[model samples]
Target: MEHRELGNSGVEVSEIGFGAWVVGTDWWGDRSDEQAVGMVEEALDAGVTYVDTGDVYGHGDSEEIIGKAIDGRRDEVTLSTKIGYDFYDNPQAGHGELPKELNREYLTEAFEASLDRLDTDYVDVLQLHNANVDEVTPEVRDLLREWKESGRVRALGWALGPSIGWLAEGDAAVEYEEFDAVQTVFNLFEQEPGRHFVETIRDSGPDTSVIARVPHSSGLLNEQVTPDTVLEDGDHRSHRPKEWYETGWEKVDAIRFLEDPDHADGTRTMAQAAIRWLLAHDEVASVTPTFRDGDDIAEWSAAADVPPISEAEYDRLEGLYARNFDIDRDDGMDVLRTSVDGEDIEAAGLDKRAASY
Candidate 1:
């Protein structure tokens, strides 16, 4: 694995970070604690130095498993986790909605819990998981300041959101705390928070970095997901529009070199090419996700160097954008619509800007 500077914090981590999302094993499926830990060990052995986990993932089981995996090699890697995206059951009813979990008390409690679960006292990066477009509040602003001041966290960032996490308006990030880093979705098929976001993070200098997650777009960009494939109900890919998720593969099935405007060049596996495109940006700190085994890990990690993509490749991707007007091309990021849309765009469009470039 290669190394990159994570914003201005001066923390250098492997270009490919280990995502603990799969280890969460909540809605997807179950993985034994031993199996999850083994995967973490595999990633670590593969030179993955940055590990990202969340407190709410699998009710913190991910953190606990990771904690056990890196019990002794704490100093060999940089650990990143988030506050927010709480998954507590509602007392009055059966439902859940995105909530602000970065308030001082909530963040503190979350951080402490994450630390305890990870069996670590401090974290390399403490991000507010899935934060939104609200103006900076004293609670979050002060809590982040405190995290740095207290040395419990070395850097700060926003996990963006399910709506903003993978796509967002960096405008909200500006004038905030310099937001040492930002994480979002930037796969080949999903490139709203495109190169511009990466450039902005780079332009921010060493003070800011970008982390790209879901580089595979929850498996749509992968090889196995064909137009005829049907995702089971509990699968994350199942959440996507049934027609598109199952049949959209046709849109990307084009000649490899032809650079079909409707597809991002179907030659190479979109899974690898998609992530490769995101990593091409000099500003992106890293691109990472969970791999089922060592082969996929090796393949996905090196996705950083998937033979140079063509400008035509990007244009093809943009053309794919045309088909999905549901996507909004914002400053430089992409996001899911949280509220109603304007009269013109009609339905909600994604906010794909990560930060201003």
Candidate 2:
């Protein structure tokens, strides 16, 4: 595995990190704590030094499991966790929305809880989950400054829509203050990020990179994304059944149909092809592709090491997209917040900021 700096935080992590979401709790039925911990240890062995988790993941179970795995090997990895609103912060999308504001009250409470659960005094990067940068008040900024100054957190960020990445354009709160890192879901299926998150790093100016999660779209990019595939009942994906089976496969179906072979263009398996599609984008710093154990690690890592497929393959994918593929049509970033937004780019003066990236 390769390593890169996570924004300007001065922390270098494995290019491919492991997300602690699956290991922490029973988001899907039941999971073995020992098995989850074993996976964490395996991730470290695979050179996956970065781990992303949140207090709400499995209700702190994920963070706790990661804490145990990184207990003594603290120096070997970079740990990231989120506080504030839960996954279902949106009232409609309401899974874990806390009925609170992000004032000093929530920030402090969130941080302490996250740290305690992770079994660490300080975190490499601490973020607010599903936050709206435009709405981030002055008080929240002050607390972010305090946390950094106090050395309790090396950096501050948000894990939401790609649109929130556009928030950096506005002279508002943490976004302009130079957040440490932001985690967003960007894969071959959904590829429009404000790219500044990693391009800034490539340019070597205040250098901010990304910790991309769901590089596979909740397993849609995986081999089993066919309509017949069944997801575990408790999976976070259980809520988005339409996205899982019926609606999310324009790109995947297009590419697979055109390519024909499972690992086409000499050695591009569907999963590898999907992973490579993201890696090929210059803006992506690294990704946190998920796995269950050591054998899973071997497969993804192998995918990363494979040589790039031929131009004929690229043309095939391009032709397929032109003929059958379509861009993401879900325009509900407010409901499903992203770290960046395209329309807001001009609104927030991010068009000029966009140029810098």
Candidate 3:
């Protein structure tokens, strides 16, 4: 596994990191504690040195499992987890409307709880879980700054959106020098805020990094889910309307050219191709791909070894993005618009009525 530095925090992480959402929640499926812990062990054994989780995942059961999984190997990985949801008040909050607590007291309690759950003294990276631009106030910034300086958190990042509606929030947060990274949904298809975020970070002259989440376009780019693939009722993907699958497959087919082995000297799989496409950019520090088991972990962890796509292919993707793949609809397009001076502006042509990916 190839490792990269996470901005200027002096922390190094594997190119492929493990996303612990599925193992912690029935939102993906019912995964037993044994299976969940084993999967984390498998990922670590396979050289995945970064693990991303949230306190709200499975109502904090995910963090508990991670604590157990890394019992003897705590030093082997850089643990990254999120806070900001007031799960203590309403543990059963829906995915869309989890109430937030940003005051100093709540943040202090949340961080201590997260550390206890992970069995660690300090988190390598702590993020504000899907906070809006307005919610990231001066008070919040000072609180995080104090924590980092005190050695409680080595780095700080802002998770862009709960879905795709918070693009402006992402753009605004990247300008802050205190943040070492920004986690955004950037894959083969949903490159809106990701592209704009990357460009913003570069222009600002900060050593900030971009953590690319949903690097597979929610499984489309990975070729794991086809048009006919049916998700179980409890699966989060099932919440997406039927139209998402239909329209998503069309967009996936449009980018089939990327699957050609010639693009990366024949070593890349469809999934690796999707991840490499994001890593091709200099701003991207890590790609957190969701994994179900050891096989999934091994496949994605090896993507770092695949040769990167040529510059010509990267330019072609840019052109395709500018045209929105001619999909004829505006659902998954990255319509995040901002001012030249880096001020937040309302994005036009964004289909707010459509279900976000």
Candidate 4:
């Protein structure tokens, strides 16, 4: 896998990284602890050097599994984990969001606990998990810098969301230029804030790298949830409206040209193509697709080696996106949670209704 540095932090990450959320929680599906470790091992064997996990994931279960999976090969990967959510004192009610504490005292405690779970002295990247714009105070900034200076954290970042639509928070992070990376839900289908952030970096000059998560647009771009496929109860994707998948499948069919072998770069699986599309943006440093199993890792880990999306294909995609993939129907994502009364979303030119979280 190709490695790219996160901004100028000197922390390199694989082009295709493993998002350990799948294993940490049954949000995707249930997998035994052994199976989770095996999947991580599989990803490492396939040359994936970036593994991202959050302390809130199964209340640190994901990090522990990742630590076990990477035992004795710690130097071989660029490890990143997020904090901010205080799941310790709060009970997780299904997929309900938890209270976040970004104060220096709480964050310090959380970071130390995370290290204990991962069995590591330090992490390459430490991010604020789903931090609201106001939560990124000067005190938090000082704490992040302190960690970096203390050699406990190599880089600092802000991971956006419990879901998509944190445009204002992402923009503020880029403008602050304090973070090495900003992780978000960005893909061909849902390109609002990600596109906005990339342009913000280009037009201005933060140099903060973008980490594209949920690159498959919740399994649509990867064809994992086909039109006829039924999502079981408690599955995270089941929360999305049925119309979302219907519209997504239609859009996926329209982009099949990306899989044609006649392209100069050669053919690509829909999954790889989805990742490649994100990499086409210069600001994107990594794409962390949720790997469900060993086969999922094998196919996506090689995305860096596939023929890249050519300029023409990219333009075609932009055109399709401009026209809403030629389908005149709502994708059920028009309204998104916003912290600043939708002012930020409006400023970003995203035509979605802003709902208070």
TM-score to true structure, per model: 0.80, 0.76, 0.90, 0.98
lDDT: which is higher, 2 or 4?
Answer: 4
Task: Give Cα-based local distance difference scores for all models.
Answer: 0.65, 0.63, 0.79, 0.89
Please write out the lDDT profile of model 3 over residues 198-274, one tens digit for every residue. 78778876578889988987778887789768777656666666666677788777777766756445667778889
Tens digit of per-residue lDDT, candidate 4, span 103-216: 999999999999998989999999999999999999999889889999999988899987888888888778775699999989999897889889988887646999999999
Model 3, position 135: C-alpha lDDT score: 79
By summed lDDT, the worst window of 10 consecutive residues in model 4 runs over 258-267
lDDT of 1 by residue, 1-357 (tens): 668887767777677889887787644456788888888898888788899888777778888998999999999979988877655532212123445554566666777888999999899888777665553477678768877888888887777656433333343453365477778766655665544466555565546777888876666666656665666766665556654453445445642442223334334455667666666676778887657666777777666544546677656556666665333323222333432232111221433322221
Please estimate how well model 2 matches the true structure, expressed as its whole-model Cα lDDT.
0.63
Clashes of each: 19, 20, 1, 0
| Per-residue lDDT of 167 in model 2 | 39
Q: Residue 291: error of model 3 in Å?
A: 0.6
lDDT tens digits, residue span 85-147, model 2? 632343423244454357787678778888887888998788777666655677777888888
| Candidate 4 colliding pairs | none
Ranking by lDDT: 4, 3, 1, 2
Error of 3 at 308 (Å): 1.3
TM-score winner: 4
